[model samples]
Target: ASARKKKGDSASSTTPPTPTPPTTVVAAPRLSAAAKGDKTDESDKGSDDDNDDNNDETVKAGSESDKDDDD
Candidate 1:
């Protein structure tokens, strides 16, 4: 047996799912003091540079494997 619909029940009461905004990558502005030839503390600067090493291929190996399986 089917259940009866309640009074004032409208399927349009719920809001529709919104489309995700187009994703974009934003870059940091060039370091002004570095660009201007004003030197900051060298050790701190070197540490920051090391943090940016692009190891995505090594770190994201699982994702690459998934893509390979999808082929």
Candidate 2:
């Protein structure tokens, strides 16, 4: 019974520290982004613009292919 109680106490102690790590992990990335002069935001916007351009090009290509097929 004493051994079982010790095991239970250890498990509960371990569980509390598990929650702390995630808060630190969440904070770490924001710190890295700030350290890099917040380029993460600019990179994300640039990626979005690239995606838009690719989508437009795909639409144009598809239309051209369709016209070729019709001819």
Can you give the TM-score per candidate against the true fold? 0.23, 0.43
Instruction: Please list all clashing residue pairs in model 1, or write none if there are none.
Output: none
Q: Which pairs clash in the backbone of model 2?
A: none
10 residues in a row with least lDDT, candidate 1: 18-27
lDDT of 1 by residue, 1-71 (tens): 12234322333233222222221111123455464454546657866666655455455887888899999
Stretches > 4 Å off in candidate 1? 1-40, 54-71
TM-score of 2: 0.43
Candidate 2 residues lying further than 4 Å off, grouped into runs, are: 1-40
Candidate 2 residue lDDT tens string, 1-71: 99999999999999999998998899998898786776766888889999999999999999999999999
